[model samples]
Target: MEFIYTNPIGLTDLEVLEVGTQACTPTMKFGPGVRDMYILHYIHSGHGTYSAKGSSVSVVPGGLFLVVPDTVHSYWADPDEPWHYTWFGFVGTMAARLCKQAGFTGSPPVRNPDPSVPVDPLFSEVLSLREEPAKELLLTGLLYRILGTLTVPDDIPPLQPDVGLHVRRAVSFINARYADPIALADIAAHVGLDPKYVCRLFQQRLSMSPYRYLTDVRMRKACRLLRSQLPGIAEIARSVGYADPLLFSRMFKRTIGLSPSAYREKAKLENTPSGT
Candidate 1:
């Protein structure tokens, strides 16, 4: 059975365009055409061949194939054993980021996760929700869950070397909210860990406490602002989480070995044209 959504409008960061399942007959084929959105296929049974960029690859049960936007591709069920597959197409602001996180970068355009955990059930669930009132929202969540099965952003700790999941979340929280009045407790709450344990994780993995790390991130951002010399000292200070220019100056001197004005002057001199 095959189905397509009537309106396919993108409602949130991610949206499902259409979804369907089909069991191919012998030698069944489609495409060698291009699509404007991303379509992912999960093979449920049997085998087939997928071709893209002048290369062809055999896909079997428990395999996945991706069709990225504007990429010409073709797939055909095996002449003797044809395949049954479920697929969904999606387009969204977060689609590219999620696709990259899922390791779907087109070169091979295939993923063969552990065959023990099949993904057909998740795809089937998408079809099951076609008639619901909250169809779009439900489909979006299911899409994220489907992608979650493939991979997650912090699976390999891309932000820092040797950082565990909790620490990574803490760091991400700090990086995003350093300018706010957030505290270590907030970071711990975000990651669902004890504040003391979060501190311990940071000290062991990052050589600093969570609060200290937050300060470091703030000071680094302050340095960039000071170098630009655009915002006033008080504004710069507040932008980096300091409400008082005096306190920000003191912290800047302590962390950077120079006052904000001094640093800005130095940056100005260094950036001055040679002959001007």
Candidate 2:
């Protein structure tokens, strides 16, 4: 069956498509499509069979399935059962690399609800966003959270030189100095490694390049600044380590699809008291 609706959230790098219905009376078919960086499906209700890479798996309520991009996959619900599911498809350079680092390699899909562990709350949130904007952001956040949960399993074997420690240090440094003009070299220097090696380690641990991750941090900070009434455009840019207001505005618009002024204005309007 053709997808009746698709909602994309965030920037081009990351997107979430929430699918509604699940029953396929006649066998449904999907041609080869790009394997997204990440495809996360939360089965809200009903049952279905999803096939990918010549392997098929039965899906049920509370089931969570993740498929990496470029893998051929399709699904059909039992005519009688009719599956109701919410699927989030996201592709980002970092997201893709992270999936691999998390050991979600190859075409075989990863099933979360394996008849043993309890379903995670993240699953519920993904299924709840059926509408627009909220659906999109929620799905994006869910994918991020899912990746976080999956990548750092408790039982994973230890890494040589304790890669996690270097990653953790890098993350800490970024968080503390995000407002500063930080670079990958600085992060690598903090961990006493060459920049190239640090980049590889970050990709292995975080599934994204340090530059993108730094940008993400700055953008998140920029959003907070937009919501606040104090910071001017130039000040906000400086706060996020961009010295040029025009350059910052361009990056902001590219990442957020709205000029900083417009974003702040909308945010103000939404928060303003009705009587005032």
Candidate 3:
């Protein structure tokens, strides 16, 4: 199947898309591509097959697939029976590093729909946000929660103080400059380590990368600004480090579920005192 990729600007540090299909007939191939990022695919229904790095697996409904960057992969639905799914694609130095911390190191895609896993609620919220644009703040909050759920492993040991110090410093840097077009290399340099090594260290400490964490910060800030009455949508966009108001609006709707202005008005009204 032919696929087109569009980078959605003004989405904090991440890019997300909502995908739905009636069927996957014949075979669809994902050509060789590398994402300097990570991909989270939540399978809501149907079935299909995915192949990555000499590993292949059949995907069923309710399955969630996590693919890390630079890994080769292809997927398709069975000729007779296609599949339906939604995917959120993201890239950031912090996010990449978080994947490593979660024990995801260049590993093959994980193919399990563990119902008992704690991520179901967060995933449900993300899907709900895609369908309802009036809930942007809620949606943005859920996205970060989802990332937190996915990357933080249950079995990892605590970090030593020195390592923890470096990790905390890295996180602080990411949070401080998430909206400033900072690069992963810059963050690594600030923390005094090689980029690749820093990524590993971040993954070890936080269970998610510094880039992903930074994206979360941006999204959170945007949501706050979008819901604030002090600034117009256009102004709010620029305040959050977005240059294009329209792009900011689209991403606001896509990720949060409402236009920035509408969200702001609603939030203001909700915050107003009764009979005031």
Candidate 4:
């Protein structure tokens, strides 16, 4: 077995985090260990079985497995032929986001539908850049290229037989996180999609971008909360993920055509007993 490790600094420290590759034997088995970063394995030859999330899958040539962070996973090479695979370990903000965008979130092995795809050469390129002075910069971009080959556009009917499934996942993620300060990237990661693609899916299905949908949802809830006269403007804004009440008021005006305070007053007056 051979392992190559590299220190993370410069471009890597900021964008990539850390990376390495390994070739192991059938006897080589790793724990039920947990990782704080993302790891992708591309099998060069032979076979292996990866067990995770209470399921096991066989992987062969032209196959890849994505191990997301904070999860316990284990794998072992085939007893007879063993397995030779390359692992590209990564972290940092872009690392997990890119992996999720490529449809790799606690799923099965990714098989290159087209066998002709040069899986070996691509991984070789990842190792070849190890000794260079610009290793981090080069490797960061190289990883992106490698992952690009594994992903398909969201619109492909064969790949996405049920667009509604993805849309529901997006909605679930939003409804779960709307109260917290969140970004489109985080939301996309939750659904294993690129933000742009998620936005496109939203626009096609709901006729609005993800941003607009989130804003609309927040404003509607805000209206109900204001009508209740329970939470103050600043408190309500914070509850909806805005740190600044002034900013939230501006957004409310833009969406509802009335300031938060004015909306609350009007709603309360309209609710008063008709004779009073």
Best model number under lDDT: 1
Tell me the tens digit of each residue's lDDT in model 4 across 99-131: 655666545435543575555777877667768
lDDT tens readout by residue for model 1, 104-218: 7657588775665557678778667879887867877888998887874546334444346676667767777888989878998999988998888777665568887677667
How many clashing residue pairs, candidate 4?
A: 0
Tens digits of lDDT, candidate 2, 1-276: 223234322343344443433434444534444343366666767777777788777878877666665456776776677766656555543555556545455455655454444445665554456554566566566667766666635455555666767776787777678888888889999989889988898778666688877886677678767877788999999999899999999988877668999999998896777799
Ranking by TM-score: 1, 4, 2, 3
- Candidate 3 residues 1-276, lDDT tens each? 122233233443333422222345456556454443467776666777777788778888877666665567777776666676666555543455455544354436564676655665565555444445444444435546666666644554655676767776787676666667777899888989888888888777545677665655555567656554677777777766677889878877665557877777787786677799
TM-score of each: 0.53, 0.50, 0.50, 0.51
Ordered list by lDDT, greatest first: 1, 4, 2, 3
Number of the candidate with higher TM-score, 1 or 3: 1
Poorest lDDT segment (10 consecutive residues) of candidate 1: 4-13
The C-alpha stretches of model 4 lying farther than 4 A from their native spots are 10-14, 155-276
Better of 1 and 4 by TM-score: 1
- TM-score winner, 2 or 4: 4
* Candidate topping TM-score: 1
**Whole-model lDDT values for every prediction:** 0.77, 0.66, 0.61, 0.70
